[model samples]
Target: MPLITIIGAGPGLGLEIARAFGQKGFDVALVARDQSKLDALAQTLAGEGIHAQGFTADVSVPATITNALQSIRETLGPIDVLEFSPADRTLESVDALKVTMENLQPQIDFYLGGAVTAVGAVLPDMIESNTGTILVTTGGGSLAPTPARGNINIAAAGLRNWTLNLNSALADTGVYVALVAITALIGGGRPDAEPAVIAKEYVKLHAERRDAELHYVAYDR
Candidate 1:
């Protein structure tokens, strides 16, 4: 079975992507900060007859990420598809930001940094093995000028460009690096945003090609 590692796993898109791929018979690794939440997701997946494993991981914390990945690798074997779908901070304007852990740039970096670092570690194995897919979920870099969601924009842009650079370098070697850029609001449809259709489009991009680097919306894909 194809083993898929989902980083930044949260409630909405994260779980939806998980279930979507899980239906395709992939062994899904659910990574999150809350063990109980991951456990619950894993249990729920079990009912679908899909092999799922939960790992307690904090995206900003390097040690926790390494430990969690190691644990998941031990439990479910090597990962074939890597999806980074972490839900950190909202892409709110600076003026709209209030005081909270989720209101800061460091909070964004915590998950972003962890995801990249973990991917760095895992890439060597995938490269040596000459296979695997790396899918990074875009936060708010889809806008032309980009969203002013504090540091999340920075981290998300980093992920987006990093995937491009990495994909360019690894294309000949068979390591597929791609992006799932969702420009719509988190609520599926806000005043004027459609996240679901954008998400499904992302899935299609990956499913159609082995080597594809795509952007979600309002930008060159």
Candidate 2:
């Protein structure tokens, strides 16, 4: 079976993505900061007949992410798909004028830095094997920025830019890269924005190996 490693795996979209890929014969490796929550999610997937294992890592700490990916490789074999979507639980939004190096740095570290670390860890193997899929998730603010979430927008935009550029860089190679920008409140009463619905897009991106980005917008922004 192929392997998919989901960074920032949680109860929402992460779980659904695990299900979508797991059902398709991909063994799931879930990475998160909370061991208990990760265990619960793995158990849930197991109940659904989807083989999943959880690894704990804090995205803000690059070393932890590197360690977790190494563990995944040792345990599940080389990863076929890498999905990165870690949540920022502590950072609070600051207006554009209030943004500073102190405030913006953490967001950058959490989103952009984390992505670089995770990709760097597994990208070598993917390139050597000549087959892999990389999917990155960011909020709509990355594409359509608002002054209200200036720091977050800046960080997410950096991630988006990198993902697009990576896609172009790997065009000649078998590895595929794409960014997923969620523009609505997931599971916020919109059937179209539900986790399961949005997750299908991830699977499609991996299977088709086309498109550099997907904007999953459920409402007018």
Which candidate number would show the highest TM-score if scored against the true structure?
A: 2
Model 2 per-residue lDDT tens digits across residues 111-152: 999999999998999999999999999999989968899998
Report lDDT (CA) for all predictions: 0.70, 0.94
Task: Please give the lDDT score at residue 161 for candidate 1.
Answer: 73
Report the poorest 10 consecutive residues by lDDT, candidate 1: 90-99
Best by lDDT: 2
**Model 1: per-residue Cα lDDT over 90-191, one tens digit each:** 444342244345554674566467667878868988899998788877755633345345445655666677777887888877678887666655654452
lDDT of 1: 0.70
Candidate 1: TM-score? 0.82
Worst 10 residues of 2 by lDDT: 212-221
TM-score of each: 0.82, 0.98
What are the RMSD figures for all models against the true structure?
A: 4.5, 1.3
lDDT at 94, model 1: 49
Off by over 4 Å in 1: 90-108, 189-199, 210-212, 217-221
Our tally of clashes for model 2 stands at 0
